[model samples]
Target: MIVLPRAMMPIIVACWLYYLLGVVVVGQYEWQTRDAFDEIRMRMDKVNDDNCQIQHLGDLYLPEDAVSHLPDIKDININPVFPNRTALLHLHNMALSRSFFWSYILQSRFIRPAINDTYDPGMMYYFLSTVADVSSNPYINASAIYFSSNMSYSPSYRGFFNKTFPRFAPRTFRADDFNDPIHLERISTRNTFTVQDLGAFPTTRLSDDYTTDFYRINEWYKKWLPDNVDKRHDTKTTYQIEIRYANNTNETFTFHGPPGADEYPGPVKWTRPYFDCGRSNRWIVAAVSPVADIYPRHTGFRHIEYPTYTAVSVMEMDFDRIDINQCPKGKGNSGPNRFANSARCKTDTTEVYI
Candidate 1:
């Protein structure tokens, strides 16, 4: 073999050394990343046993062949058994595309929203709500499925990704607008009926179980523990829901969720024969903070610096109980979307036209 000149040998050795160093650096960085993930998970797993009771909703898994695509949003498709006000609406649990929501993956798994890609689970909390009534007059169905979107935390990449989707303006809109004309019937600033209905049906369903009148819905399950917000607001709201986790594993932790808006809170009790769950997006993920470590006292805003991921979700849902008038044939006992689970009624209403 011909021997290399001295300078060439140094250069070759330097190149080889550089490659070795890069491998080491990358491995170290990955290890650090994993360590950070462990910290986040440790913090997330801490459940305060003080004020609230733990209700483990369900666990997450790789999408099966049947549910690989998103399904009807209203059907409580994350897991069938856990009940909600309107199925405690657990949407999708997004991670770094390949990791669990809790694994510190999503924050760094930045992706560009391609053309016509509406929801980048990394970018926004797409709170999807459709007009609850599909009557001839779309505006009349002012009611909507309220209280969606868990608190989703995205890493602030140069500050663009950190801000919440402010409102309907030139830049963006609520994802619910995409729910098709049959459901979205022009209930916006344009409609006078929409204004009247928004005022009439202000039943903001909350993520947490709160104190209720305990009349028809007799639920005593306290909110998820390690309470950040003082108000278990749902307890005070007109309707309440409790989700018992389908998982028996003790590794479960209660994630903190953003409260649902009270402005367009739908009617307390209503049926939806008019609205079809099949017409809606099948799987919805309401992202929440994986770790909610601090909250400023005065503002009542939870200060979060945690990554977001969810292991449990509802794959299917059936209303635990609805009026005999709506689920007349005991359809409530059946899984989601059997008959007229669409009818909404008040606890006091004796005469339901539906």
Candidate 2:
């Protein structure tokens, strides 16, 4: 046997200690991944529950008692129209849209850990605008009551709209705000027009003025924003267009001028519909942030490249035309109504009580 130097023993001990530490670190990482998975599962379950409740509410007609229940109903229209086949189709579309939105929210908020995150209050405002668009359909709005309940429980969401949204002063409406010719000229100057514009300009005029109209409808929201905050010159401020069909189905579209192209000079990004156009029917345009500029922390949580425009246009078909029987239970048939398969038909109806 050869004798070893005493110094060699310390080296051996140090190596052993390092190996142990590595094992401990790996173990901790494994545990964290498992925890993340479990949390995601729980959130998914809650979403499913909320979805079921929303579905139930949508299915409830309450024709005889509808008048008496007006105040209690989540979406109360004075003279409500019963859903026709087209309307049912609309409902299906709306449900799917809402489902997609909430699913994305769950993935971002609970499933994924925040990494190099920036918060943009505009995104939340856009989300609200999207929700409002869908809510125009009474059934869709009724379904959304369930979603609002769920969102109220989220901390990130609360921090976004309740705390941060008011910090950026929004744009004021002038005749130019509704002036489509000037608006179109501005948009054209920025090279915003394309076959894939996703119907953002339904008309040349401001058919819907979100800034003024939204404040009028949601008085409480006005007070939620800070009083001293400057409403002008916030690049994050945006104008969004949301369209909902009679079925309570909807889509949200967003548009913003490029940074330095107009009075507002800063980066802007649109969300609502998915980020990938191939997967969705929504469109978004954003001005890229300057390369050298330092953005405030937690300013824009979801960032895509600047000077980049992306549109997501998910093919939508009239749900009534779908022949549910033709397609097998789990397999999707080719053509427009690919989403009509029963496998994708996830419903939530528990929100309707009696």
Estimate the Cα RMSD of every predicted model relative to the unseen true structure. 30.1, 27.5
What ranges in model 2 sit over 4 Å off? 1-83, 109-112, 116-354
The all-Cα superposition gives candidate 2 an RMSD in Å to the true structure of 27.5
lDDT per residue for candidate 2 within 125-192, as digits (tens), equals 53353445333543221121111111222234432323322112111110112335657644322222
In candidate 1 the C-alpha lDDT for residue 81 amounts to 42
Q: What is the lDDT of candidate 2?
A: 0.29
Error of 1 at 309 (Å): 10
lDDT of 1 by residue, 22-117 (tens): 998887642323332243233334422231123232211111211111223333344454333332222221111111222222221222332332
Residue-pair clashes per candidate, as listed? 39, 29
Question: What TM-score would each prediction reach against the true structure?
Answer: 0.19, 0.20
